[model samples]
Each structure stands twice: as C-alpha cells, then as structure tokens.
Target: MGNFIMGKGSRPFVMENQMLMRHGLITGATGTGKTVTLKVLAENLSEQGIQVFLADVKGDLSSLAEPLENNPDIQARLETLGVKDFVPRSYPVTLWDVYGEKGIPVRTSIAEMGPLLLSRLLGLNDTQSGIMDIAFRVADEQGWLLLDLDDLKAMLGYLSENAATFRSQYGNIAPASVGAILRSILSLEEQDGDLLIGEPALHVADLLQKPGEEGMIHILQSQKLYLKPALYSTLLLWMLSELYEELPEVGNIDKPKIVFVFDEAHLLFDDMSKALTDKIEQIIRLIRSKGVGIFFVTQSPMDIPESVLGQLGNKIQHALRAYTPKELKDVRAIAQTFRESEGLDVAEAITSLQTGQAVVSPLDPDGTPMPADIAMIYPPKSKIGTLAEERYGELMRQSPFLFKYEQRVNRESAYEMLSTRAEQLAREQEAEALRVQLEKEAKEKAKKEAKNSPRSNREGITERFTKNIAGTVGREVGRTLIRGILGSFKR
Candidate 1:
C-alpha cells in the first residue's frame, strides 16, 4: 500500500467506509500535525454517516465549523492522492462549555457526578478521598441533594458540625480530615468549582447525536480549561460514565455512537492518586460496551497508564525526537504497540516520520490488527490553525440550543433554598429574642410597682392573677413555661 488519502482511490484501508466510531487515537508532540490529523479524521468521519466529538484544546478547531478555502497545497495533495469528489464542506459542530458562559452550556449536575469521580477532582489523597466519600454517603442519607460544590461543601460542613454524631455512623470524621477535605474542595472551586458546579450541565445524549447533515464534525473547545486538569479529567470521565449508564448493550456495531478525542491526555494522568488512576482504568474499560470510543492524544504512549494503553486497540503515533535515552526508549515502546511489519523498522520510522505523517495501525473492520504503514495523513479541510477570534461566539449565537442554554437558568436548588432557610431561621430567632425582652421588662415593672405600693397591693395582685387562671384548664402552665428555658426549641 501506498498513501491512502481518505476518500481518494477508494481508501486502501476499511476505515474509509466507516470504523472510526469504533474509536481511534491521534498523538504527537507540540507543533506536529496532531491537530491537523484530528481535523482530517474528523472531516472524513463526518463524510461517513457517523458524527464526531473533538476537544479543541487550543480553540483552533473552531475553524472546523467554517468552509475551507481552497489552497494550492491542499488541492495538489488531494489531486495526487486521487481523492474523488472531495468537496471542502463543514460538519455539524457544537461549542460546549463546562462553565456555560463561553459556549453552549455543557453541564452535568453534581447529582449525576457520583462520589468516585468527584473525589479525584478534589485532589484528595487516599484518606482524604475516603472522607470525601463519607461526605457523599452522608449527603445521600440525609435527603440532601449534592447538586453542586456548595452542596458538597454543605455536606462537609454538616459532617464537621456533627462529627461526634457522625463518628458512630460514618466512622471517625476527624477535625484534621475535615480540614484537609474542605481545603481540597475549596481549592477546586477556586480553580474550576464555579465552572464545574451549577445548572444546565452537559447532557451525554447531545454528544452521541449526529448534529447536522451526514458527515458533519462536532468540536469542543478546551483552551480555557487547561488550568483545571483535575476538573477536566473528571468531566471527561464523567461523560464516559454517563454514556455507559444511558447507552444500552449494542453487542457490536460497524461504527460507534461517537468517537471521543482526549487531547493532552498526560494532564489526566500526571501525579494522579492510585485510586483515581484505577477509577479511570475502570471507566475506559467498561465504556467500550456503550459504543463510545476514547482516544488519548499525548506526546508519548507513556503518558497513558499501562492498563489504559493496553485497552487502546487503535494507535496513530507521530514523529518523536530521540535526542535523549528516555526519548529513544519511548520511541521503541511505541513501536512495540503495533503489529510488527516486514519492511518497516517502526522504532526507526517513528523518529524519521515526516510532518503530517504517522504510523497508522488501525484495527481492521474484521477486528484483526492491520500492518503498520507509514501513511501520509489526510490534510484537514479547515484552515490549518484556529479560526479567528469571535468565531466561536458567532457559532454560539446561531446555535439552536443558544436560547436554551445562552440565558443562565438559576433553579431553586440547594443554594437558593439554603439562603431562604437561613433567612427564616434568623427571623424566628429575632421573634424569640423580642418575646424574652418583653417578659423581662414586665417582671422588672411588676417588682417596682410592688415596692412602691402597699404590701396588700402586691398580695392582691398575686391573688387576682391566680384567681384569673384558676379555672382555665387541667394543663400545667408552670411546666410549659419551664420547658421553654431548658428544652430544645423548633421555631
């Protein structure tokens, strides 16, 4: 085989028809054609009946929604590759924002985000994660809704306030544990808490849909999200988990519901706890059943866990600089990931691959691995780099879901209800204080009147008061008055 210019010469590989929904990976160092390769694959996938989901880490992918202006190089490449009817067209693209301010609101409620995924985003270590877990469990039991970070924070606060009470039920929530866990969640809020928590979160079903006419691409911008790696990973994994929960068992299909591209995958694995890592492993393993495929785009395969790397059946490795021993080791390891080819020195080929080129070793439609081929990656139909600024905003303005998510909807969730409850409690306390003040004033006035007047007047007052209430009822009025001072008040 020669250059299988997707759509040109009937694609030498079976993927030309449709297999990307099964999933794929596009990885390379910065400045390489990772983004371009992604665009090309996205365009091709859109060409098929399937839809695509792209994480536009740098925001450049916004150009994908626009039509590609014909350039000499792209035209020449397409002609030489024998591409048939290659019309530069735009795919169905949706702009999604976790914060819901920048793009269409893509949010998942905290109730939907269970404890396992939430713990890692909090950056909780083993013990701290356990405490966080307990907080979630306690929230569920107390009829509390953990809809957002504030809800979780409230859960933590309730635990600390009633630590003595919860110790028996939840097993020892220490002051130190409380401090560590609260600090962790607070830090996350400062970083991504506001963005992660709230109403109108992402719906996994939206991602699964083929948004437009057949073969249109869907891209997600991730430039603003680089700072919150923990939140980013959690959200990404949460998406996968949601897919698993919603998608029924499809056994096997020629294509997937949607192909997920996880660019900058190293951010997800860097310094993550063992528990977090294991949870990621579980999601990646099980999500396949839901017909959702995941691809990790990183500098080297080492950035991904061995468990996850093992699960990724499709591999597209680009050039690597083998200037250092570790670099060379990484190159060799990447070579081992593919089916060994006779004419190819994959290890050597990796270091020598030209720009816009990679070792494509997709699992053939038959489920058997194809031979590693040094294929010329298809040129992206979109502009080489990000679309101009204001491009995404324009897209959002025209989006159908604009009115649905553009205007922020503040539902009466925990935050609003808690604020209301606090006000009610304050009013109740104020009324009780006023009643006590009035009673004190009456008692003092009664004593003064007794001292000024004759002793017969004080005796007459007591006799009159007793005579006034003597036949009222069998109820003990004195015990009721005493109960007000010593017993708990519900008002």
Candidate 2:
C-alpha cells in the first residue's frame, strides 16, 4: 500500500492508504477546490489499485480519461510544494449515463430498487408510499416481475382496478393513493426517469477493476441528472445500498475495496423522511466494516446531518464565505468540526484561506483524528476540465462493457403479464356476449316463423267434433266383427 501526499503545510500532508476506508468529508463553497480535491484523491486511489465511483455533475470529471496537458500554474505549484516525481497521466475510466445519450446506459429493475427507494425517488407521501408497498407485495405474490416503469405502471393500474380483490389480503388500497402514485410515476417518466428503471440492470461487481490491474474509475455523467435533485440523490443512494448489501465483510482491511465519492451531498438529505434519514445514517456507520469508504463532497459541513457528520474520520475544510451573520455562524460551526491545531484560529482561517488550500484532518495510523492543518491541495495528474469530444467518443467505443448495457432489454414482467391477462379476459367476455346474442337471435327467428306459417289459422268446432265421432265409430265396428268371427270358429 502507498500513502499519497495531499499537499504541504508546516509539514507534508499525507493520506494513509490503510485509513481510506474510515470515510471522509470535503466541504467548501463553490469554486473553493472541492472538485480538485476529489480529482487528487481519485488519482491517488486509482494508482493504489482501489476502485472509485463518483458523479460528474458539471461534465468535467470525464477528463480523468485524458492525460494532463502542459500548465504553467500547476508546474509552479508543484515546485513551491517541493513535490518531485509528479507525472501527468490518465487513469482507467468507465462512463455511464441514465439517458443513454453520453455514455453506456445504466439501469436497475423496479423490483431490485424495491419500494422504499422508489417511494423516495417519487417523493411520495406516507399514504402513497403504503400503496406502493402493497403494489410491490401484490406483484410478488402473483409472481410478476417488476422490471421497468411499464411494469410498475401496470401494477398500479391493476391495483386501482381491483382494489377490492387485493384489499382482503393486502389491506385497504385506496384508489386515490394509487392515483397519486401513478401520477408521481408519470412525473418521473416526464423527467426521463423511465430510462433509469429497466432490464440489463447494473451489477456492482462490474464496477470493480480486474485483478492485477489499475483500479477503474466509474464516472456517472450527471450533467442532466443533477437537474432532478430527487432522482440524482436517490440513484446514488441506491448504488451505495447495493454496495453494502453485495460486498462481504472485511473488517479493518489494509485498503477499501472501493471508495464512493458523492458530490452535491446536501441534495441527499433535502426533504428526506425521518425513516430514510435514519437508514442512511445507519448505512454510513456500518459500511466501513464492508471495506467501503464514502466521501461526501459538498459546499458546507452544515449541509450534512450532525449524526452523519460525526462519522467522517477524515476532514477537508475548504475556504467558506461568511459575509452575513448567518453565514458567520455557519462558518463557526463548520470550523468547530475540525480537530483544533495549536496556533491556527480554525474559524478565521476558514474565511481567509485561498482556493486550493484547505484545513486537512486525516485519521492517524492509530485510527484517531489528527489535528487540522492549513495546507495546499495537490493538483490532479489528469486534465483539469472536460475531455475533448473526439476523445470522449473514442473512450466510449473502447469500453469493454459498452455492448453489455448499451441496448435495453424488456423481458416478460409484470406489465406484459398483466396486459396478457387483461386481453384474455376481454376476449372471453366478448365470446360470452356473442354466444348470448346468437341464442337470442335463434329464439326470435323460431317465434317469427311460427307466426308466419300456414298453421296460423285455428280449426272450426264442427270439423273437430265430426273427426272425433268418425274415429270412435270405426274402432267399435272393427272390434265387433272380430268378436263374431272368433265365436263362429269356436262353435
């Protein structure tokens, strides 16, 4: 394992590879070098064969695939920090997109996402969320696979239509709640969120680099995704949850199996339900044992909940603005989060520190928080901005997993199954209706024939009496002749 130098203070600032799994936080105002710090950490981790996953909201982090070009300012900073042997190079990068426009498409099935995360993404109220849970339970019991937006939509439609049938087993499912959830689904679809739920789901193992190779940096292209705050946060949270569930426990490993960098970290907690907030807090607390480190990159520490904020062992505080009274108070609170140094007034340094300089507090080798130091951050070895369009295209073509997730797959799931059932029911109903119509037509034809036939007239009473008298006389005459003949033969 290799320890990377962060930058220079009174002494060299370094991040121990073994302590990377302890988790960390990087906070500052916009343009205060948060992105640069992210890039630097990614480069070092990749060099150490540690996989990294981060979102590129501004479309700039794609430059990790391109080598750094000549920059005088970077060279000067390296010399000032007494840094030697800094090579400009690129790392392995896999690009992903939810919309499938910029890179390989990434998707997860609706069932795999489960009801809770889907509810969060849809911004559902408690009643609506309960309906969603019932919908999922019904789908599971019926052996229907919820694989995409269409599947979920069909499930909701079925629930609405047959609420009474399901109510007995799953409880009362209100039509209004179902409608609200459907409307929420529609709203999500309008935002191109439909693309995020489907087949060919992303496997976390695919995010890891192969053995005896440099670690791969999986960058999610979030330029448009970030526009939808709820979706962006929920997607990242789902990926994190998946990692925690999938990875094996390796307590206190020399290095993390993977490092997750969540940018725009505040959006994750915005309007989050208390239950969800507690779940997230628990994941952060226990995920370290799974050899996964999560670093949250945001504008301010105050953006994070106090419970989560306390779990970060490494602290990187970039310069923050404090022009107003509220801002001053926030800065002070942010300053107090760090381990105090001997001479540095942490709060004053927070507002006065230049860009690319931050107060760093990484965990010591003994797993304890080290005192904060005002230090300069090292520049990334890769390019500082977005990758060129031509290079971006070339990299996409070269990606090994391109064909795997490029095409969307829609297997037989809840949507198709429900549709088939509905169609069959419709056909049977139509057949029964046709049978009934045919029977009625036959009866009407018989009645009409009887009314128009020659037997429509009635017989006269005299003719009916004469025919009855003639028939009786003929029978008596024949019986008398036969009796006389039999008596003569006997004599």
Candidate 3:
C-alpha cells in the first residue's frame, strides 16, 4: 500500500515504513482532505502488518473495511499519477465502542482509569479531585477494586459517610467536595460514562493482533463519545498510557509495532490541566521507545503544543484557509517548518493546495529529514465515507469479541462491596439495638422481682414479730399466772 506517490521535482516521494515509529502529525482546515490522508496512512500501515488503533470521531474511517467506490475523479487522479496496478480493495477491520451501540463494547476498570484521569473525565474541581483521590485511596486500602462508575460512586459515598475516620489517615474529605465529585460522576454517567467503566477491560494485547499479512485495524466508534470531549480525550490518553506502561521497551525498531491516530487531537489538550498536559507531553516524548507511533490529526499546527510538535518527525499538512490575519500567520508558521526548496512558496502553496493534496515531510532511510514536498496524497483503496449502520452491524458480528464484550461483566467491585458492607453494618447495628433492648428488659424484670421480695421480707418480719409477741405474751401470762399463784402462795 505504501509505494511512491509521485516524483517531486525528479525525486520520488515516499513515507519510509522504518521511520514511522518516530511519530507524525496531520493538520488541515475542515474539508481539506485530512480524513482522506488519515485513511491512506492507516490503510498503508495495516498493509505493512502494523496494528492500527484510531478514534473515528466523525465515523468517516469506518469505510476502510469496504472496497473503494468507483469515482471518475479517483480514476483521473490515478491516471495522472501514472498508477496502472492500483486495485481498489478493503482492509481487515474490527469495530469497537464504549457505548456498545455501533461496535463491540470497549471498557476499562475505574482503577485502570485512576483518579487523575477520572477527575479530568468528570471535570472535577481541585477540591473535588482531591476528594476523588481520597476515595480511590480508601477503596485501595479497603481492598475494594473499582471496576465501574458505580464502584467509584459507592466508594465516594463510603468515604463521605466515614469521612471522620478517613480524615485521620488520608486527609480531610469534605462532604461538599465528595458531593460535588459524586454529582460530577453522576453527570458523566448520564453522558453514558457507565458504558466506558467496567470489567473484562480491554486487553492491550487484543489491539496488537495481526491476523494475517495485513494488521488488524481497530476503529473506535466515537460519534457519541466525541460529545464528551473530556471523556473522548481521556479515553485515548488512557489507552496510550496503558500501552506505554504495559508494553516492554523495544527501542528503535524497524517499524512501529502499533500506530495510534488521534483525530481532532486538540481536544486532548484544550482545558487540560497543566499537570496532565505535562504528563501527556512526557508520554508522547517517551512512548516512541515502546515501538509505538502517535499521529495527531487536527485543524492546525497551533492546536499542538510546541513540545509535542518538536517530536513529530513526519508532518503531513493539508490545505488551510487563511481568511483571517491570524490564520495567515498560522499558515506562515506552518510553511516555515518544511525544509527550504527552490520555488516552493509554502505559504501560497498551502492556501491553493487542492483537495487530496498536502505538504508532506517524512523521514528518510538514514533517519534524516527529507526535504518537504507538495504531493498529491494517494487515494485510499477503501471507501472514503462512513458505512451504513446495517453494514456496521454486519462487520461487528464478525469481530472476535462479538459476544465477549457485548454483555457487560459486573464483577464484585467497589460498588457491590461497599453496598454489601453498608447492608452488613445496618444489620449489625440492628442486632446491637435488639441486644441492648433485651438486656434492658432483663434488668427491669430483675429489679421488679427484687423490689417485691423486699416487701415480702418486711411482711414476713412483721408477722414473725407479731407471732413472737403473741407467743411471748401467752407464755408470759401462763408463767405470770403460775408465778402469781406461786408468789401468792409464797406471800
């Protein structure tokens, strides 16, 4: 799929497969063939047997699985480029979705997402983020695995209820902050964040699968996901982080083991916290050693940070509209990035470049910068637009995870564990109350018996006294009578 596109002033233009691991960028205004270039690169990389993972924000890349439709313009371009052996064909593809509507559900554990990313996903404030971190810490200490949004929610509730105890060890977890975090999480759930956080989490190995000569193309269906920009960006970043953390170091390989294309790449940085932005920059700078290449697709180069832009060795810049002064300035800055060529006025060329044309600068065989050239991007052999919903379903049915990821696995995580603990605690409190009540009743009955026994003892004492007095009086009278008779006789 990666052959010579055209002769650039008698020099053949090509994207060397070996230097692809160095990473790349694709920038252009809307309707300027950015999606087409992305498709071309994806198809070619897959042809080279390199696994490809890309987020299809507009659902445009889904058609890569279908044969390119015949178009007169495509034929003319092929003829103009003097390509005789060009055969339109489809590549192997697998579809995935967080929502489970368009493809196999792709999910990850809440712990895998971690508090930092989750905070970004939920758009939590600093205090709320701090509370979230505490919640995760509490969950970890309690041996509770957070596998879903509900798990995090339950953990937050648990922490709020036991805030006093947690404060001693973890720090103050304000109920207001906890509530804010919970509300944020609830908001995310309303946005279908529940579908993204779960068990049987996506295995990184699944993405590295190359079934045949052509690597498998895993396209994340992101039409609905794109609505939540934070979630969308965080999802891709987490995937990148996972790949970086999990994959063994394979420094400077012949080619990339996997290629990740982040479309609408600006969303990953917009409103992104400084710490997170630095983290992302660091990942982009270092993950190349893992034999993974990241391509950022966006509207303009300004959307990318300077630190990130410096690392992108290969640049494919599509057309830009310079209606405003700032846009023209941006165009000039973009033009200056290319290596100087004799008569190639990059600024002018950028505004006038036709659709399917781009200013490309890929690395050479010796890891040297190839002089930038204006080249007509080779048309993708696969379909250029979205596949029908029925067609999309048909392809999904053939995926390896047809039934595996379809049914969500709700393993006992923080949610169920905390819920069970709460129920158990309530039962224990109830039992304790019952025991106390029983003990109180026993004490009251014993007191009543003791009080009655005292009265009975008094009654017995009085009766015995009366009896003794009567007996003594009678005996004394008899004795007295006897004594009186004796005394009278004696007298």
- Give the clash total for candidate 2: 0
For model 1, state the Cα shift of residue 14 in Å. 4.1
Order of candidate numbers by lDDT, starting with the best: 2, 3, 1
Model 2 local distance difference test score: 0.87
TM-score of every prediction relative to native: 0.83, 0.90, 0.90
User: Which 10 successive residues of model 1 have the least lDDT summed?
Assistant: 1-10
Give the per-residue lDDT digits (tens) of candidate 1, residues 374-481: 776667766666676677778788777767655544565555555676678767876775686567557656655665677736566777577446523313453455
CA-lDDT, candidates in order: 0.70, 0.87, 0.83
Report residue 268 deviation for candidate 3 (angstroms). Answer: 0.8
Across residues 1-491, which tens digit of lDDT does each residue of candidate 3 receive? 13334223235568777677778899988998888888888888888888999999888999999999999988988888777888899999999989888888898889999888888998888888888778777777789998887787788778887888877887888888877887887788888888788878898878997888888999999999999887899999999999998999986677788999999999988878888888888998888899899999999989998888988988888899899998889899989988877778888988998888888788887767777778887778999788988988899899887777788788788778878887787677666655655665575566547546756466667775775576556555655554554454334
